[model samples]
Target: MGRTRAVALVGMDAHVVEVEAHLAASVPGFTLVGLPDASLAEARDRVRAAMTSSGLGWPQRRITVNLSPAGLPKAGPGFDLAIAVATLAGAGVCDPESVAAQVHLGELGLDGRLRPVRGVLPAVVAAVQAGRHRVVVPAGNVDEARLVPGAQVAGAVSLAQVAAAHGAQVEVPAVDPVDPPRSPEDTPGGCDLTDVVGQATGRWALEVTAAGGHHLALIGPPGSGKTMLASRLPGLLPDLDDAAAVEVTAVHSIAGTLDPGTGLMRRPPFEAPHHTASAASVVGGGAGIPRPGAISRAHRGVLFLDEAPEFAPAVLQTLRQPLESGELRLHRAAGTARYPARVQLVLAANPCPCGNAVGKALDCTCTALARRRYLSRLSGPLLDRVDLQLDVLPATRAERRAGARESSAVVAHRVALARDRARARFQGTGWSTNSEAPGAWLRAHPPAGSAVRDLERALDRGLLTMRGADRVLRVAWTLADLAGAGRPEQDHVAQALALRSRTAGPT
Candidate 1:
C-alpha cells in the first residue's frame, strides 16, 4: 500500500484529500473508489498513459486506488499526478515514505508532461494549514505556489522528475512543461473623473459611493453620460489591504480568472456583465459544483450593470442576499459552498425603452403604460437597497465650459480621509465601512432626537421600509465622515434623505 495527499476546491475553500493505492494478488484490473465526479473518475486512463509514456512500466496486477473521506465529493483533473505517484510507490518503483510526505497538485498530460491546474495557491494554503508544508506543483505554477508563506514548494517539468526526486532510480525524460492557460489579460479603460464633463450632483454621489462602499443607481435619458460616470468609480477607490488582497486572490484563483504572473490582486476588481448574461453566469453556478460568479469575482470591488432594466428579473433579484449581507451561500447536491459577495453594485438605465422620456419638450416617444412597464423591471425591493438613487441630467453649456473640474486624484484624497476616519471609529471591530455597521448598534448610539426627526417623519409616512431606514442612517454616517463631523448633524440627515430619494430633481 502507498499513500499521498492532494486538494479539492469547492468554491473558495480547499479541502485536503488522501490518495492511496493498493495492489492485490488477483487478476489484472484497476478499480477507483471514493465519491469522485465523472471528470475525476477519468484519471485512471490519463495516469496510465502518462506513466507508460515516461517508461515506468505498469504493474500487471490488480490495482485499486481510493480517495479517503469517501463521502466528501471530489472533482477536477488535478488529482492525476498524485494517483500516478502513489501507484508507483505501491509498485516499489519509488520510496513510499518520500511520496507520502509531500502533497501533489497538477494535471499529467498523455506524454507525462506536467500541466498547470487552477487553484494552486489555495491548494498549497490548505496543505500548509493541514500540517503538510512540502508541496510539488507543475513548473508553470511555480510563481503562484511560492506566494504561500512557509510552504516548501517544488516545481516539476514532468511526472518522471517528481518520481526521481522521491528516490525512484528512473531516467527522467526531457519532456517540456505545458504552459498554463492564462486568463485573458485585462486592460484598464483608463477612465478618469475628468472625462465626465458636468453634473455636480452625479459627481458628488460617485464620491460618496466610493467613500462608504455603497451601491448606486443612475436613471436618466441617453447621452446623459451615465455610463461614463459609473466607470470612474473604481478609480476613486483605494487598493485592497493585505487580508483583502489574499481573499480576493483566492476567489480569482478558483474561478480561473487569475493571472498567475501578477502575484496578488492589490487593485480592486471591476466586473461589468452584459445585459444578456444568465443568472448562473452572473451569480455563479455550474454542472457539478458551484463556481465563483460575477458577484463573487467583484468581491471587495464594483459590479456595474449597464441598462439594469434589460436584465432578467430573476438575475436582478439574486442580488438582494449579497446586498444585505456580504456573503453568498450556494447549495448543491454535492455540498454547500460559500463565497464573499461584498461588492458595490452600480446600475445605470435609460428612462424608457425608446430612451427619450426626459424633460417635457414634446420629444417623448413612449406612452405612459410602456414607460411604467419598463421601469417596473427594477423592483421596489431592489431599488430600496440602493443608497444613492438619482436622475442624472444633461450638462448645460455653461456647466460644460466652467473651469477645471475635480480630478480623480483630488477626489480620491478626500475618500481616503473619510475612510481613515471610519476605520479608526470601527477599529478592532469586524466592520470597516459605515455601510457594514449593524442597524442595532447605529440606533443604540445615534444622533440627537431632533436631528433624525425628518427621517422619522418619512418612516411614519411609509415612504421607507425598516431596512431602508437603516440604510439611510448608514449613509448619514458616511456623509458625516466625509464632512469631518464628529457625529451626524441635522443638515447631514436631511441631505442623506435627499440623496436616498429618487426625485433628486433635474438640476
Candidate 2:
C-alpha cells in the first residue's frame, strides 16, 4: 500500500486530497471511492490504460483507490496522475517515499501522455499553502504553475516521466512547454482616451470613477461616445501590484481564460460581456462545479455593460450582492464556492429605445410611456448603488475642434497621485480607496463644516437616499484626494452633489 497527494478544486478554492492505493491478492478489478464527480470516477479506466500503454504491467490483483477527505466533492480529470502514481507505488513500481511528498496535478491520455488541466495556479498555491513544497503538472501548464512563488514545480509529459522521477526505470520523450495562443482581444493596443473627441463631463466622470474605484452609469444617444469613454477607463487606471496580480491571475486561471504563456497579468483585466449574457454567465454558475463568470474575471478591474438597458433585469439585479460585498458566493448541491469580485462596474445606456431621445435631430418615435419604461428597465435600487451617473450629450462642433485633449498617460499620472494620497490617509485603517471606507467610519469622522450641512439638507429633502448620501460622501472624499486637500471641502461636496443630480431623471 502507498499514498500520494493531489488537489481538488471547487470553484477557485483548492482542497488537498490524499490519494491512497491498496493492492490485494484477489480478482482483478479496481475501485475508486470518495465523493468524486463523474469525470473523476472515470479515472480508473484512464489509469489502467495509461499504465499498460507505458509498458508497465498492471498489478493483476484487486486494487482500491481512496481519495481521503472523502466527503469533499471532487471533480475534473486532474487527479489521474496522482491516482496512477500512488497505484504504481503500491505495485512496487517506484519509491513510495518519493511519491508521497509531491502534489500531482494532470490528466492522463490513454497513451500515457499527460494532458493539461485547468486551475493549475490555484492548485499549486493550495499545495504550497498546505506545506507541500513540490508539484508535478502537465507540461502545457508549467508556466501557469510557475506563477505561484516559492513552490518547486516540475512539468512532465507522460506517466513514464512521472514514474521515472519517483525512481522507476523508464524512458520517455521529453516535451517542451509552448506558449499558449493569445486571442486578438488579449493582445495589447487597446483604445486610448485621447481618441475621444469631446464630452468632457463624461471623461471627467470616468476619471473620478477610476480614481476612487466607484461604479458609474452613462446615459446618452448612440453616437455620444458612451462606449468609447467606458472602453478607455481601464487605460487610465494603474497596473496591478504583486498580490493583486496573483489574485486576478488565479481568477482567470479558474475561469480557463488565462493564457499559459503570459505569466502574470500585470494590466487590469476588462470584461465586457454582451447584454444577452445570462445571470449565471455574468455572476458565475454552471452544472457540476460552478465556474467564474465575467464578474469574477473582472476582479480588480472594470465590468463594462454597454447598452445596459438591453440586459435582462434579473441579470442586472444579480450584481447588487457582489457590488456591495466585493465577493460572489455560489451555492451548489455539492458545496459552495466563493470568488473575489471587487470590480468597478460601468454601465452605458441609450437615452431611449429609439436612440434619438437626446440628439439634436429629435427623431425619437417612441411615446412618453415607451421612453419612461425603456429607462425604467434599470431599476432604482441598481442605479442607487452606482456612485457617478452622467448624461453623455453629443459633442458640439466647437468642442470637437477644441485643442488637443489630455492623453490617458497624463490622466493616469493624476489618478495615481490621488490614489497615493488616499492610501496615505487610509494607512493602517484597512481601507485603500475612498469608496472602500466604511460608512460608519465616515460618519464618526465626518468631513469639515458646511459641506456635511449640505449633505444633511439633501438627505432631508429626499434627493439622496441614506445609501446615496454615503456614496456622495465617498465621492467627495475622492474629489478632495484629487485636489490634494486635507479633507473634503464645500466645493468638493457641491461637485459630488451635481454629479449625483444628473442621475435623477434619465439614468
Query: lDDT (CA) for every model shown?
Result: 0.86, 0.86
Summarize candidate 1's per-residue lDDT along 12-114 as a digit string, tens digits. Answer: 7788999999998889988888855878767888899989988888889899999978887786439999999999999999899999999999999888999
Model 2: number of backbone collisions: 0
Cα RMSD of all models vs. native, in order, equals 2.0, 2.5
Off by over 4 Å in 1: 185-189, 448-450, 505-507
